[model samples]
Each structure stands twice: as C-alpha cells, then as structure tokens.
Target chain A: MKKKENKIITDDIMIEVEKISMRFNLGIEKGFSLKQGFINLFNIKKRKELKAKRKKNVFWALKNVSFKVNRGEVVGFIGANGAGKSTLLKVVAGVMKPTEGNVDVYGNICPMIELGAGFDPQLTARENIYLNGAVMGYSKNLIDLKFEEIVEFSELREFLDVPVQNFSSGMVARLAFSIATIVDPEILIVDEILSVGDIAFQAKSEKKMMNMIGGGTTVLYVSHSLAAIKKICTKVIWLEKGKIKMVGGTEVCDKYLKYMEGK
Target chain B: MINNLKYVYAKYSFLLKQLVERDFKVKYKRSILGIFWSLLYPVLMMAVMAIVFSNVFKFSTPGVSYLTYLLIGLTYFSYFSEASNLAMSSVVANFSLINKVYMPKYIFPLSKCIFVGINFLLTLIPLYIIIIATGTGLNWAHLFLPYSFICLFLFTVGMGFILSTIAVFIRDMFYIYGIIITIWTYLTPIMYDIKIISNSTLQFLMKLNPLYQIINFARSIILYHNVPTLGQWAGCGVSGLVIFIIGIIVFKKNQDKFIYYV
Candidate 1:
C-alpha cells in the first residue's frame, strides 16, 4: 500500500524526501607509497586487520529521513554541528545521491549552499562574481545583465580589479552574499548565509530573502539560529544526530529548544 | 545521456568558462614572464635537447631539420603531460566545491583540459615561425592541423577524466601516474627516431601508445608535408573516441559517490 504512493506527486509538493540514507566510510590513512599499497593488498594478517578497521569506519550520516516540501514554502532546517543538516541538504540538491530511498524535487533548484562556493581567491571580485554566477547556473549573458547590479550592491567599486584574496573577510562575505542573491532562482537552497558580514548587511540580506519569498520562490534553509528561523521559516525540521527528531511549526522549535536546554 | 548532457551544459556552460579562466589566471599570477612562459618553456626545452641530441649525439632527421623535428614532438608531449597531470588532480583539488556546491564533477576535469588547451595555443605561432625560419615549406597538408588538434584534445580530455576518477579512489594514483607518464614519454620515440628501433615487437608496442600515433600524425602534416593515410586517420579517431567514451561513462557512474570521498 505504501509503495504505491512513493512516485506520485499531487498538488503543492515541490520536494519530497523518502527514507533517504547516507553512509560514509571513514578510516585512518598511513602515508601513501605504491610498494606499501601493494604489500597491504597481499598480506593475509594485514588483510584481516584492514577488515576490522573497515568495520569501525562506517558512519551513518543520515538515517531513514523522510519529509515533504510544499510549493512556495520556506522550510527551515535547525540542527547542531554534525547533525546531518548539510548532508540532507546535499541529497535534496542532488549533489549527492542517497544510499537508500530517494528525493523528488519538482522545481529548478539554485543552491547557495556555501558562500563563495566556486570563487578563486586569486581572482578579482569582478571575476568571482562572474564565476560564482556561472556556478549558480546563470549563463554568461545572464551574468552580463546582472554584473553591475552585483558590483553596486557589494559596494566594492574601488576594488573591482583587486584579487579577492586581498579583500577583508567581511568585504569578501559581502561580495559572496551579493552574488548568491542577485537573481532569485525558483527553489533556493540557502545555508547560513544570513549570519555573514556586519549587522546592517545581515539585515539587508534578510530583506532580499523576503523579496524572493514574496516572488513565490520555495526555499529549504539550514541555520543554527532559532530566532532567525522562526522569523523567516513557515515550517521547521529539527535534525538530531542524523535523525528527524521532530517536525512541526514554531512548536517544533519550542520542543527543540526545550530539548536543547535539557541536554 | 543526451538529455543529461544538455541539462548540465545548459546549466553550467558559463561556469565551465569561468573555471578555465580562473585556472589560467591563478597559474600566471605573480609571475613576471606570465603566458610567455608557455611559449618559452617548449622552445627552451628544444634548445637544450638540440645541444645534447644534435651536437653531442648527432641525431639525424631524415629530410626535415632536426630542430623542427624535435620541436613538434616536444610541443605535443608537453601538452599531453600538462593536461593529464592537472586533470588528475582536478577532482581532489576542487574538494571545497565538490561537497559545498552542485556543479557537475566532469566540469572539474574538463576545465583542466580547457586550461591546458589554451596554453597549447600559445605554442603554435612560435611553431609556425620556426617552420618558416627553418625553410620548411608550408603545404596544403597544414590544413589537417585542426584535425590533428581535435584528436589530441579529445585524447587528453579522455585521459584526464579517467585519471581524475581513479585519483579520487586511490591517493597513491598521484605518484603512480608520474611513473606511468615518464615511462610512456620515453617509449613514444619523441626525442629519438622510429628508424633507430631494431626490434619489430618493441616497435609494435610503441605504435600502440596513442600519443605516439598522434605525434606522428601531426608530424606527417608538418614535417613530412603529406596528408596522413586513411588508416592513420582512422587510428587517431578510433583511439580518441574509445578513450573519451569510456572516460565519460566511468566518471558519470562514480560522480554521485565522489561527494562522500571528496
């Protein structure tokens, strides 16, 4: 009965995650040499030792995670570090496929997953804008259309030719935020972008996000700030150690907050 | 596969351009010589080889000047090594983007090929000037330049894709590839002549190396001043296509798994 509904999408379902799981194999690595590698491959006792190590290497980053994202909904993901927020986000973005189950997204997704995700520090601010825009899936013509607006918003008029490596951290953050938000993609996946730069810039960035939401774009956001999540997100998914502990409205936030206080 | 390709290209074609440009910019930054180094490098190597091979060993070119003969080989071999080495590291080097961003993994290796191809372009004018300077007459066979280049370019990009994928799984690939490329360079008869080899079996093995086939293919047009035989043309196309097709399939299969490893 449940298997029958797995593939179908009714109205208002923009993204659907069904029992997605991710497993990471982690291990200690000795320094690499061809001779050492070949020896490790053949040694019987060493093979058994390696097998034991492999057992210890298994890390379940996400386990049986299921959710649904409706159209034009701003869903917030709140979790502690290593709670699989980014992992789950990557699976939904189709950057990484899940080990089990699947995610169905019915919209064009533009992920601002990490600030300056494709920027070369050695390249100038102007260069990075074009590069980042391309990474955001904007064509060269589209970038040309929005290049001046990005520069104006960044307010680095004097430093257009200066390499981004030389820019201040806050200044770099401004440039990154400006490029990510310049064009509103259909389904925006934002990860902690609002916490960057100075206070005024944060406010300005929040306002830009509000404008995108107003334009009927769906968003899946990951952030550590509960107050900010409550202010912007209509629904919240609280992840705890690779599991969806609770899912609801601000009540989920209240329960998550209470649980955090208890912990 | 066609639909998938169209989607990725439509989405990230501009990103691919910026990435290639970024590589060149980073490569030449803070260097006084800048891109002249691209031209200077092969020429300087040829000069050193001419002294040792021509003056010391007195190696012979059958009809063409030894300078032009060695320069063509050096130019092509350098392009092969540079493109492969950069591409081998393409996936691992872009670890930050692989995990954080959503661009296709193939773009990483493809960008390396594009970057090296740009540097290869800098080698041509100097090559043409030398060909004219050494009294090597330009012929209609030179029209095959674009054909030879496309074959070589496909071959390099294919190798890059395969190497970058393997490097993701095995860290030792970094060292293993160096040894492999060195052995490959020596076996290809780049600095030495094919006529010097006496063993038919060893000679046959040398012919199997695609770079050997590609270099001679270019040399046929440039120095030999003749169009390649249909058989030679088929050899270049088949080898390049087979390698490129295999590379794309392997890369696509493992691309999703890469996020975990990278």
Candidate 2:
C-alpha cells in the first residue's frame, strides 16, 4: 500500500513543457500523399524554393512555447479565439504531439478538453457514463462505486435510462461534466467546459470546480470568462496569437481586459 | 515501448471489453431477432452455397461429406472476411475518439477485431451442429480447431492494424477495398476446389494465397478427420506470423502521424 502512490520527486512541479511547437500544413493541396510525392521527385528544385515561401500553406499553431506548472497550482488560461489555447491544452494533455520539443507531465491528468467526446449517442445515459469512465481509464469497480453519486450530482436521476441522443445539450453537458470530474485527478485540464449549461448549473459546477481546486488539485483552465478566471485562478497566463503575452496574477487579466477593449 | 505488458493489459482489458460489448449490442440493435441473426446468417449462406456448389464443383475432400467440407471452409472464410473488413475501418470509424483521447490507437483496431471475432465464434455453434447433423463424428483432430482459429485471428488483427492505418490516409480505401475483397473471395477456395484450376501456373499462384492455406488447413481436420501435414501446418503458421509482423511494423511506424491524418 505504501508503494502504490506516485513517488513525489524533489520538486513539486507537475508539468514542464520545453519549447514545444506545432506546425500544420493547412491548405488542401499543401500536404502530398505517396503518389503525388513520387511525381514531385523529378520536379524538386523549383518546388523546394516554393515550399520555403509557405505563403498561407504552413501555419504554426504554437511557436517555441514553454511553460511550467507546479502541483496544487490553480492556473487559468485567458486568450482570444485562435490564440492556440486549445492547441496548447491538447499538447499538455498528450492528445497531440508537438512537431518539435517535448512535454513532461509528472501526474495523472484528466483532460476534459471537450465534454462527451467519446459517448455513443445511441447508448443510455447510464451506459455513456460507464463508457466515458473507461475513456478516462477508470476501472469498472471504481465506476461502480461512483455511479450513484455521479447520477445524483448531474440531477439526471429521472432520465438515467434514456438514450443520450435524445437529451438536450445542457443535459449532455451536465452528465459529461459530472462523470469527468468524479475522480480526483492530479491535473485537470478544463477547456471552455464551464460555458455550457444554465446559470444555476454554472453556479453548481463552479462550486464543484472550487471544491476540487481547494483540494490541492492542479488545474489548467481555458475559458472566455475573465471574471471566473479572476475569481478562482491563483495565476493567469494570457496568450495572443499562439504566443504567451503575459504570466502573472490577476493584474495580467486586467491588462488583458484592457487590451481586449481597443486601448 | 510496450515493455509493461501486464499493466497495459490490465488497464486496457476493461476498455476493450466495453468497446467490444457496445459494438456487439449495436450490431443487433435494429434487427428483430437480435443475436439469433448471428446463428442464422452463416447457416443459411453455407446451406445455399453447399447445395449449389456440391453438384457443380467437386474436386477434393477425399474422406468427408460435402456439407462437412463446405462448413469448414465457410467458417474460416467468414471469420477472415468479417475480421479483416471490420478491422480495416476500425481506426477510421473512431475519428472522434482518436483526435480527442490519448490511447495507443491500436486499441480501436483490436477492439473491432475482437467484436467481429465474438460473432465469428458464436457462428461456430451452428457450424459444428451442421457437421454433427451431416453424420461426421467429432474426432481427436478437433483439438486443432482452436489453434487454427487463433492463427487466423492474429492474421486478421495484424491486417486490421495495417489496413486501418492506411485507410486513414487514403480516404478512397473503402471503395478500393470493396473490389479487392471481391477478387480475394474468388481467388480463395471457399465455394470451389483449388484443384479445378487445371493450369499448373494458375494452380501454383492459387496455392500462394494465404486464405487458401488457412482454409485447407482447417478442412484437413473438420472435413478429412486427420492431422494436417507438417508442411500444411507450417504454411498456415508462417503466413499468419509473417503478415502479422508486417502489419505491426507498418502500423507502429505510421501510428504517431495518425493524429494529423485522421
């Protein structure tokens, strides 16, 4: 039992991303298959020079980005659309590999990047809960233990037997949120998850998130809600067009808010 | 990269079980008879094909009845077709999960193989019933059945891994593969005997087909009631292993880039 826990290292740092970068060729014709590539071998020199220009073909989602997240730190990400917030979260969650550099995570991460990601729409809510639990790598026994509590939290007690495809978007989000947050993860990466559901559910979810954050769980949150960021996050990192613009306390959010205003 | 097999196996088995079970349920969801459809499907096909072909095409199966011979070949061929075809689309079908989650990716393809395999195994109940009904008594050589199926299962899984990986990049594989499977079914000795080809060159090429070897190996036991020759056993064993190795190598090499392609 003593040897079961993760060995705590000398430092409390939970995540260290060293200059990670992701490059994608965006246009339809930008990337070539084996057949087209074989034909291009003879037309090499001219194509090589054209490739260097790139010109709307190659886009860097994240360029030489580096960040460190310590254990028990509640960090929030504030960024505009296309600021690479999702891409950065994806890289940290190990959902996607970077084209260059690496990410080292020292804890078991539960990434709620998109709620209800792997749910089979035809299955009942109860079935989807188990399916989603498996996606998060929870054992059947663990899910069996948490089953009742998850249902009670989602307030879908009456509709547990219904298929998820017939459920409203709010009901789906509520269910997804409850299952994803049931386990006490070392690192919780939340990407615009709190934006869904009603204001009442929003208050409940925020309380739940606060409870987890209060329990010394390291959180990496991405939300358009700056007030929520200022209220809950210990630190805020502001990104602008795939580059980290600022990293500090709530003052950074103030600066970002000011920047977002046309000042 | 897969050094910790025990841990990986323990963690993934539940996930795999859930995936396979879900697919199994979804399989018979729209049908009225549900899982009974599994039993009826192969039996009907075998009856129809055996009745038609037993008269028009007679070549080998020296010691056994035609129904027994047909059932053995049909079972292996059905397993091969279902397993490989399902496995091929496994990765492409789960694009939502693939892009959003961080799993080994092989899990999707492997789960598809196991899902189809469960159906394949269930069909065996009917297969043996047909054999017993045809007056072909079970013999000591029946023990070889499990091993032969395992070899075919491995071969299908390996091919699934390779084909799913390729299918992700080449969106046209669904159309292209339809034609290939049709041609492949004709090449294998499923409905007819391999001996009827007549031309030595064409006969030799037909023997080179992996399905021909696997179907023959299975028939040697269920149809002939004898132990397959060492050469036949080796051929089945080596082709499964060889194709499986190639599939794994190709799948692993391209697995990392699957995120981008899918």
True contacts kept of 1: 0.85
For each candidate, report its DockQ versus the true two-chain complex. 0.66, 0.61
Query: Given candidate 2, what's the lDDT at residue A199?
Result: 92
lDDT of 1 at A105: 82
lDDT scores of the candidates, listed in order: 0.84, 0.84
Query: What TM-score results for chain B when candidate 2 is compared with the true chain B?
Result: 0.94
Taking all chains together, the TM-score of candidate 1 against the true structure is 0.92
TM for chain B in all models? 0.96, 0.94
- Candidate 2 per-residue lDDT, tens place, A117-140, comes to 789888889898988889878899
Task: Give model 1's docking category.
Answer: medium
Task: Pick out the ten consecutive residues of candidate 2 chain A with the lowest summed lDDT.
Answer: A1-10
In model 1, residue pairs whose N, Cα or C atoms come closer than 3 Å (at least 3 residues apart or on different chains), thus clashing, are none
